[model samples]
Target: MPVIVLEASDFTSPLFLVRTWEVLSGCITFSLVASLEPPNPLSDLHSTFRIFCMFVWCFFFTLTLLIHILSIIQFHSLIPVSWKNLTMTTAVLGALMGLSASVVFAWMVMDHGGRLTHTVAAAVASCITFLAYSSETYVLRTQAHEQRGYMGSNPGLLKILQLWGGCNMIPLVMEVVHSQGSASGLPSKVLSWQLWVSTALYGVCVLMSLVTVVVILGDLAGRCFLPFDKCLAAFSMIGVLLYMVATVICFTKILQLKELGNRAPTGVTELIIMETVVASITLLAYTVDLAFSIKLLCDRSHA
Candidate 1:
């Protein structure tokens, strides 16, 4: 008797690596968005919630990577043969990723004082998300008639995603254009105001996400929801909530220091410093995600 290695094609034989990676990349994004946490290089610098969020970020980050692996391993040689299927899958993933990315940037959209960069990013992303969601809705509806309205899709959250996406940049965009008070200081002028706005927005998004989650959980045992789709929605939501909380903390600190002047921490200072570190890490993550998604999709043809 000879031992044989199992190939992914035995099950869903049409799928292949690169195509699969694309789908996985978008799917993983949901968890990654929910898992963002500010990293602390200063041993003493700390926020309990922030720490917890970081842990979440790491966890989701891992999950995202793991899904990439699954996509690679499972579809290593099947996806390319069916270009039509592959294209459809890529579109679905893009739409999902766009929707999830909007959640990822919710904090940016909610920033008070209103940075135009954030506003623009949010707005552009939201349009992307809505377009993707609408397309997804059409696809889903075509496949399953029972999924009318998410069983508890909070209109409020949907509204926020839309409203926020419509305008992402306010102060930042203005500063870039006007150069008014764009000077470098321990605490940037725009930072505090942004913190306040982001914090408040996160607070609201959290509430909306929480309500939506409860509804999802309640319906878990019901007949309508698909396990994978429901799970995707829930996980992506976790990322949105984390951004909200972290952003709120940034806002609160700024407001507290508003009374202190130059003596203590300011919101702008904190975000600038914090984001400075996280930006590199997140960029790496995004690159990895893109490589996994696109490469996997492309690899399907090689097999």
Candidate 2:
């Protein structure tokens, strides 16, 4: 007779593997799209942005692959757990990958508004990656802190996650509403202003995410070195609050200004639907994570 053994940790290992693989898969898929486009189709600046985006995606692909390999070994107990720095390092790398992608997306949008399929899709995908990475990094930090008993970890962070999730969700909803309202053709003035506003709001979202990364890093090592995590967290929430307000204003204005001259083109309708799907997935990920974090926080408080 043989005896089988399992640890509590084993239950969650598969989730990490799946999450990491999703990031890698997304990177590869988008990189292929960005790379296959004809060179110099736009201008020198546009060409350079595409090249940079391709490189960034490939970098994340390789990095996540390495992380996945190590994680599998770690989960099986084939490797020692003494490497406390590994997850933190990976988290920082993930953040950097996200930031790089965000910059490239912003550049593309500036060069050619989000009307372009490549630009819009890449922008949406990059934002999803940023949220995914940020959430995972937070989880890693929370696990480390809980193990060491160095911090009462989850509640504060969970608050941030919940807020972040809700706030980020508003813009995506607004985007979908705006898309539907403009199912007809868009006037040039309306299109131009919409593009600029969307770009600017994206910049704010990026900054909010970056601050969350900073807060996590500041606390992860059990150091109060930054001493300003709370302040930054407040600002992050404020940023999202403003985003929510802006989204409402934008949505209303889009409806008011939309032209009814022609029905939406099939391609345009399909693209908007695809983007909405992507946004929905991201929103669901954040919401689920937020709920899980809340449960963990409650369990810890009771314990």
Candidate 3:
């Protein structure tokens, strides 16, 4: 038997490039924001939170940058297997910072008599960034070995993912649309179509996810309609298809509603749409990678 050598470039994919950009851009943004005047000069609480948020972004993204550099250097074995933990930490910190910054932005809005100013816009951008990172973390979790294996120590992990998609992700998408729509002040007429379609698709996904859980459990109970692995893969493919469709619809509506050139909406709607598009693409890439890895694992197991 010949020994196979894996090179650093072998693991490099478009997703890796995208994530590298994500971390580097975030670092630059944080640096710039920190160098500027406080986000809200009048409110000490707001200014403090703004600084804190920038710090969090800087720290998290810098760590991510290091991780990528390690991967690029082919120090694969030196990289922690618990990489998902770093993602989870980043997600949690982002949530805290986003929410805190939102409070400051909200105060600014009320202070300015409910007008959508730059501060409000910044708040919305922070929220969208938070959502995007959270979604990315979800995708990262899917790639972890802990999420694989049907009869391993973590037997309920796959079931948990199914239920999470049904119970949490579907609702989360709806909330994101609702929030962005409200922020954009989109007309009821314009909101009806994309809103309806996206929600409907997510609803289907939710139902399918629930059915998948039941089918998987039934298979585990020895009443298999198909192999558990096959069922899981089928559900993953179908769910990804529906999700991508809904995400596309959402992106379309955002494009339709976006103002052009100098008259663009200074609110958070445009930023939310842009961030969602990036996150959706990232999720799609992650799903494809997961499928490919699973196939490779299956092949290896058979051999």
When sorted by TM-score, best at the front, the candidate numbers are 2, 3, 1
> All models: lDDT?
0.38, 0.50, 0.51
Give lDDT tens digits, candidate 1, residues 1-303.
Answer: 233444556444333333343344434433443333333122222233223323423433353344345444554244323222222333343343344344424433343333444344434534443354445334433543233333212332232232232122222222222221333342554656654664454344345434433444344334445543343344344434444454454455446556666854323454433432332332233234334434544575586
Clashing pairs in 2: none
Candidate No. with top lDDT:
3
Per-residue accuracy of model 2 over 1-303 as CA lDDT, tens digit each? 233444567647744754575465557447635654544223433334455556656666676666666555554244333333344444444554565567545654665434556655666677666666666566666564644221224433433343333333334444444554466466857766765666565556556555555445344424546534444444545554554555455444444444532444422343344333433433443444445545655676699
RMSD of candidates 1 onward, in order: 16.9, 10.9, 12.9
| Candidate 3, 1-303: lDDT as tens digits | 333444666556543654565465555555544444544443333333345456656665776677666556646444434344334444433444444444444544465454334444545555555554555445555664654333111323333343333433333355455655665688877677756765676676567555644444334434666665556566567767766765666576576656444444443453345435533643463366347547855996899
TM-score of 3: 0.39
Every model's TM-score: 0.29, 0.41, 0.39
Please give the lDDT score at residue 275 for candidate 3. Answer: 38
What is the clash count for each candidate, in the order shown? 38, 0, 0
